[model samples]
Target chain A: MMRRYLVGLILIGLAFALFPLLRQAGVAEAPGPLASAYLENSADDFGAANVVTAIVVSYRGFDTLGEVAVLFAATAGVGTLLTRRRLGKAVPPPGRQGGTEVLETASRLLAGLLIMFGAYIFIHGHLTPGGGFQGGVVVAVALLLGLLAKPDAQVSHRVMTTLESLSGAVYVGLGLLGIVLAGGFLDPRALPLGVVGQLFSAGSIPLIYSMIGLKVGAELSGIIDALKGDRS
Target chain B: MMLEIAIIVAGVLMVGIAIATILTRSLLVSVIMSGGVSLLASLVFLLMGAPDVAMTEAVIGSGLTTVVFLYALSRAKQPDDEDAAALASPPGDDTDGGQP
Candidate 1:
């Protein structure tokens, strides 16, 4: 009786909370002044046709740096918690042989395509709707798929750690280069801004975003590897 | 007009799925329903002209989160020494085994 009443109360409260948001649904509004300015100048200023990419990688990159740090910390925490030192060799592999034949075959075929798609997303991030984070997730998903397929394949922790460290260092180094050679930290203008829509046009935005993609991919793979537990 | 109706239907379905996710006693069902909620939300986002957000929600929210939860569930220990129950039950309940 108590539980039912509590649930009812919570539902009522949620309804009340969502009512105002519901009222605003389907109502279109013009962009605010800040948005208008960003839209107007981002292409010219950042040499990136995708304004969101400009903002994420250059206009407000410190916040992105912090977000990457947070992801790194989370990966580190998961690794520390689930590794062989902490958890003994009690839990065995759920699948003794591997994934089913169909799964293994399908993932084997899809993995290459998935990786290529992820690379394309991050590389074209400066000109398109997607960016490093989404691309990184796709890459991590590919790694996860491969793990699901093979189950006993050796994932080199050394390689993952090295890639993660190198990418993170490159991101920060580029930020420092921005401060030294351009307007501020992570300024896309650190290098020459070429034509707005070209591949090499965004002046290090693509480079920085690629680093971010690699870093995020490696970090997420580390977390997944940790969770896979004592496969060795 | 059609878009608005589609969005409304998606929103209502999300609410229904959310309720189902909470009300389910089985953890595996709950986790899957949670993923369903994300999948619906991604559709809603795509309708709302935010494909980037929709992709993120679909991949991370619906895809990776489900896999991670299943891993954690598989790692969790059972109460007593019927080790087969843990392995046999498929992480939630092969035969309604979230019981005392």
Candidate 2:
């Protein structure tokens, strides 16, 4: 009522005040200093056509590993919060009988293709717009579709957990390998940089991104399973 | 120019959706509208040339969050429905409940 209106008015006034200041700061027409350097040397440094990928999977690989750990922690937290012992027969709610036949058929038909596409995205991350996180989410979406189509179907928790653990371990191992073979930890130059703009050209960037993709996909699937709960 | 116009339109729509989400009484509707806001924001991000962020926003913000919210809403509603059913039943049914 009155308070809402006053708050809205204050927000509007603040926006108005900030608008001129924002306009006074000219929009960037060129890359900044750091970006310019990255752009200039990304090809030679990482052999990655996608500069963003080079920066994320090579230059800032440690930070990306931390991000993965954060996601793993969040997924674990969600599972812990949602854990409950099974009491009785797990009944499907009324009127949700595994979706319509078309949905079931479509999901079954599309799941494999979606997974392949996700793999492609992450594998070609050093040469394309998508990377591990994006591809991982796409993979999760594919799994989610399967879950929606078959409400009673269960993703194998043991397999997913194993994949998550293995991928995380491999990512760390690769980082350590970088230290042993190259300049420092997580350095992509540990492996020979292949031809530029090719799929296998970005040294260890593709491998690291692939591991990240698998780990993220497995973690998200685990979270989904935790949310679905054990009906057995 | 067309891209700028599209971005502006999406931005305005996002603002409207945000307001509607806040004002809506229904939790489900609010959840879905927030997803819509995420979607529009993703579009805005794409226009701004950040495909990576835009994709993340579209997938995680809109897709996963919506699914999680719906699951939570269903879980929250179940207890209320069970409580109502229990309340509707006769109090004398408590005699057999001690078997648990």
Candidate 3:
């Protein structure tokens, strides 16, 4: 305990000592050339009103592809580590009483709205501040709410796996189409860049992001379901 | 000026909550305080004109993280009501020098 305090004190002292260096990086106002380029060209190039979405879905799409794979691996790792077989013995819940009537009713009332809201966010990825990752997590949160309200809820692993796999395959297929029909891999220009700022714009970016959202939502829900250890 | 002051206040609150989170005896309090820190930080992110990051921080960092931590805490080692009350009794000054 004494060693822990000592280590913590040393860390705090080091942090204060390093605080002066922060001033040097705090005053930059203008976007750099690379940032400026992306901001300027994203709407025109991909019809994504949101520059960040364009970058994530089109400009550096390969990175997003890799990130999706990493999320997949993490979900898989969690699923394997906390297998249904392992949880079958049941470390009995700590006197967790069932949800109140109000709680269950509220969750039921709210779940549909949340699911639609999540889809809307992903569908408007090109024009909004949010995209696949945020939208996907929102969907997972809906699932979580439902689970908490009804602890015995069972999410079919087969359905989740199939959805995730299909979305992932279609995402990759879209990228391959970009290679053949457009400039390079994951190019949004493969389809015509519709009117900018419109719902139907951004060429393939919205489609790719929708796929990513479904894939991420399915992956995260699977992880949550596995963690809850239901459906044995 | 209002934005600047708000940012400063939120930043200070975050720092205090972070310290409290680390020093709290109860794991539940620690998780809650950390969530408070994230919630304040998300407000700061919004003030800094990054709505995208702010949204993510609020939803994931604050909401989901707190829920996940509570789940893990419940599953890991659940102290009884008496034990929790005992932990929450001491506040600012660590009478036992940070360890029971």
Clashing pairs in 2: none
Pairs with backbone N, CA or C atoms under 3 Å apart (clashes), candidate 3 = none
For model 2, the DockQ equals 0.29
Cα error, candidate 3, residue A107 (Å): 2.7
TM accuracy, model 3: 0.87
Where does candidate 1 chain A have its weakest 10-residue lDDT segment?
A85-94
**Shift of residue A1 alpha carbon in model 3, Å:** 7.0
**Residue-by-residue lDDT tens digits, candidate 2, A82-158:** 65532222334557655788988999889989999999989989998889988998888788889878888878778
Residue pairs clashing, model 1: none
| Candidate topping DockQ | 2
The segments of candidate 1 whose C-alpha lies over 4 angstroms from its true place after superposition are: A1-28, A93-95, A99-109, B77-100
lDDT of 3 by residue, A114-196 (tens): 98999999999899899988898899899999998988767777888899999999999999989998999999888889899
Which fraction of the native contacts appears in each prediction? Answer: 0.29, 0.31, 0.18
C-alpha lDDT of residue A20 in model 1: 88
TM-score of chain B of each: 0.76, 0.76, 0.77
Each model's TM-score, in the order given? 0.86, 0.85, 0.87
The 10-residue segment with the lowest total lDDT in model 2 chain B: B91-100
